[model samples]
Target: MTYTEAAEYILNIPKFTTKNKPEHTRAFLSFLGEPQERVKVLHAAGTNGKGSVCAYLHAMLLAQGKTAGLFTSPHLVKINERIVINRDQISDDAFLDIFEFVLGKVKEMEAEGLPHPTFFEFLFGMAVTAFASAGVEYAVLETGLGGRLDATNSVQHPLVTAITSIGLDHTAILGDTLAAIAFEKAGIIKPGVPVFYADTTEESNRVIEQRAAELGTPCKKIGKDAYEILGIRDKHIAFSCVNAYYGNTTWSLNNIGIYQPGNAVLALEIMRFVFGEEGRPDLWREALHELKWEGRMEEVLKDVYVDGAHNVSAVEGFLRSLPEKEANIILFSAVNDKDYEEMIACLCRNVDTDFYIITRIEDKRAAHTKELQHIFETYTDKPVFVRESLEEAIDFALEHQHGRKIYCLGSLYLAGMMKGYCNSGEQ
Candidate 1:
């Protein structure tokens, strides 16, 4: 099969439950020789920031001259972006070659009456197989959804497991409260394994700590055991590490947001914990600045900041990163299942921001601009322009932005789409 054909085949995979029975991923991986066991893994699970954390970890490892494999989900532009080696997306030849090889085995399994794997499970199997065959020294796997039953959890002997901040996301699967969500995030913690806990909510932290105690894993909090961001200036962030293997060293993070310090510190701690003194601080510093985490508080164009702050907690972090009450306009859109009201409401209360609500295309989950317009009327009498697509949204915001900054938020999918548009247009 060609890469395009292989991609089409995988897209037909059905998403299944977040349950404990790993029958699907197990069967798929077993057919592929369980290659996930071949490399050192830094498995990460959380409601938000998993992708960002994975990118940071991959970058750090690559800087140390280690060949790292990165597996993320729901690509913004290209499907191959979901599986990367040393910061580069998988190539056409490799993708097609693996897909054809895997396809034959999948057919054989089905011929023998084995249950077919879901889209995510099949991809997981393919990625691990590819990484193993490619001789990846390390693999950073991001959870597709909730942790415990996530297909990526099938790996054993993870070098370190880290949880980004826990919050109310995937409530139907992860549960209602912060504690319930934390339980799902905590599912990644295995007995005797070291876990990195970022600066999360106190409530979520308690739940995680309880789980760690039960599992007999040492859960080290980033701010307490490791270090965190001491301060931030325009385009520069200062970070320090204490319990980290890199020791008490501080450096500049080229990323724009202060929230990244948590992920940065967590990455350093995980790297040090996994590699100890062999861990290089210089590599960590170089990678932190050079890391390209798309749609996570990224500035894709001139004076325009894009973030996939789909959930309430993410929105809060994004808002916290912005300057105080500097009047501006927020160009936003969201998927239907997200807490758009709470997210937009939080932004409204926090910033002197106006709204230019846009409707994302193609995805059935997208919320309509009319719905957002109605919600905005209840919150503020500020001007709200409606657009059908991201291009129209960008143009509208730029036309009226004048000296004000443009913030595109609410959905990561939309951010990806806008990024592609900007990239193609040379913006």
Candidate 2:
């Protein structure tokens, strides 16, 4: 099948609540000779920072001169971003080949009255196949949803499982409380496997600790107390970590947000567990110095910044990363499922935003521009403007920026769209 046709087939499939069976993923792997079995996995799951943690781990592994694969979700620009090996996205031709192979197998299964794998499952299968074929030393996986039934969780035993800060995200499927969501995220902890998690609330820590105890798994956590940020100067954050395993090590990150110290500590702890003596301080320095993860406090243009802070906790992180000076204009959009009201409240609490430009992104789940404006207006006296088109909202923000910063946030979809808009040559 052509790559475009293959993308249409996978992209059109329902993302959640489909005929995707957890066992069917395993069965499909069995049919394909279980590529996952050949690769050592570092599985990560949580409400936020999962992607950032995975990105850090993948970069560090590569810096350590290891062949690594990364499989993340909800692609910003293209579907190929979800799969990578040796720091390169799977080529379109390779994606087509893998998709056609999986589609052929899926057809065979359908002919035998077997259910089809969901879109995420298919892409995950492709990642496993590609990683194994390429002989990657490690594959860092970010869970697509709640970890208990997430397709990536189908890996029987990852080398090390890490859970980022747990919060009230995916409430409908995961649960409404922090403990319940922690329970789902802690599902990645296999028996006797060492698990590392970012420090969160007391309730969340309790839930994760209880799960680890039941499985006899060793659990380590990185919290604010574990790391101290020296300063953030010119988009670079200098920090000192006082973790038990890694000791008191000072490091600096290039253009990373204020909240990244915790994620960095988590990645370092996981690396300590996985690579041990092989973890070189030199490689760690190089990785941190050049590490980059898009859609998180990213300065895409000269003074315009974009962040994917869709939920309450993530918005708080995004806010912490911003300059104390207020933004001249803020362009915001988010999915309907997010707590944008709280997110906007956090933004207002942190930044003296002058104007709020509410926009709707290209997603069926996007919150309407009018609804966002209503919520944002209730939080701040900033004049709220509505533009259903993302490009127009960006234009409005840029045109009125007046030498002050223009910040776009609230959703990764919105951030991705704005990143494309700000970087377009025509702009």
Alpha-carbon local distance difference test for all models: 0.80, 0.85
TM-score of 1: 0.94
Model 1, span 238-261: residue lDDT tens: 867664345566766766675777
Model 1 misses residue 249 by how many Å?
3.5
Model 1, CA-based lDDT:
0.80
**What alpha-carbon RMSD in Å does predicted model 2 have with respect to the real structure?**
1.7
RMSD of 1: 2.2
Off by over 4 Å in 1: 15-20, 224-231, 242-248
Which residue pairs does candidate 2 place in steric collision? none
Which pairs of residues have clashing backbones in candidate 1?
A: none
Q: For each candidate, what TM-score against the reference?
A: 0.94, 0.96
Indicate the TM-score of model 2. Answer: 0.96
lDDT of 2 by residue, 258-318 (tens): 8888888899888887778777866787888787788888888878888887778887787
